[model samples]
Target: MRYEKGRKDASRSRIMEVATQRFRGDGIAASGLASIMSDAGLTNGAFYPHFPSKAALVRECVAAALEGQSGQIAQALASGGLATAVDAYLSAQHRDNPGTGCASAALLPEIAREQPETRQLYTERLMTLVRQVSAALPPHTSDPEAVAFGIFATLIGALQLARAVEGADLSDRILAAGADAARSMAQPRGGAGQEPAETGVTIAAKTERER
Candidate 1:
């Protein structure tokens, strides 16, 4: 018997949602299709109707995740500028909740090893994210796109490190350090021979050095 289109679509959405969390919480390779299907309340056979293969599901999920993150970052930037966005990304809640946190922090290594098509999709989505940040930067900032990339990389790397290590104190420090690094990168991208503006972290460091 043929299922209704709406039902099929709903089933596909459920599968993607469950798989996205599973893949992020557990590494992609570790999250088996059987487990994902089961978690989605579907039998193994129900999988093929929505997606031809596991890789296809992964590609779609990653793309969706990046799109969601871009929207969130845009909102944060709008409300409190890049600083708020950076803090939200590197917060302890984000670090502890890999299942619901940044896809890059959860799966960058796997992403690097994905097939060419998956990488291409990720690259395009990444550029969209970069553009979102670039648009938020100051008009006087030099190479805003490049600065956005630096800021994103800093946030992603710091979040991953924070999640990997043991201990609450160390993890919190990692988040703080990551926020500082990301903010430092977000500082004014000065023109030639001009000083970049000082961030809070930099000002504190300079004061410590003077003392």
Candidate 2:
């Protein structure tokens, strides 16, 4: 019984691993169970025993993706501080690779239109990310949560815009602009040689208004 259970668990994990990549690489709505199962090297029949419904599978995939992203952010914070996290997140490499990048940037817009349960799960994970970034913020900040929120919003919006824009030059500009803004946020007020903070530009917002 134990061995059977272990194997079942392994199969379920493998399915999730494949599903995460597919869902991120392809939009969640476009990634079907049959495709995911085949990608996992399992029969379609194997899916139901692990996940009762497509929504269930989606929820799990979202959870797994967010957890993975959270770990990456946490590691960045621990190893190189907020500036490093900002540099890593707002780079061309991250912008060009949605599947291996941040889940919020890859899925938040679509997830916002999903069922309440899906949104709730996303909200929880987003807050977890907020807290992780918040803790790394300078101790004297007036409100760490708000600062974290602003930075989080900036990171996701920048990455999305970078990927959405038509020209490589514009996209790279968007990312570089975001990295500069984030670096400003991480610096202390009145710190030596630090220039005054400027209002950040968000190409996503401007592009949406134009559309």
TM-score of each: 0.94, 0.86
**Which residue pairs overlap in candidate 1's backbone?**
none
lDDT of 1 by residue, 49-115 (tens): 8999999999999999998998898899889998899999999889889998899889999999999
Worst window of 10 by summed lDDT in candidate 1: 183-192
- Model 2's TM-score against the true structure: 0.86
Per-residue alpha-carbon lDDT of model 2 for 100-126, expressed as tens digits? 777778877678888889889988988
lDDT of 1 at 53: 97
Return the top candidate by lDDT. 1
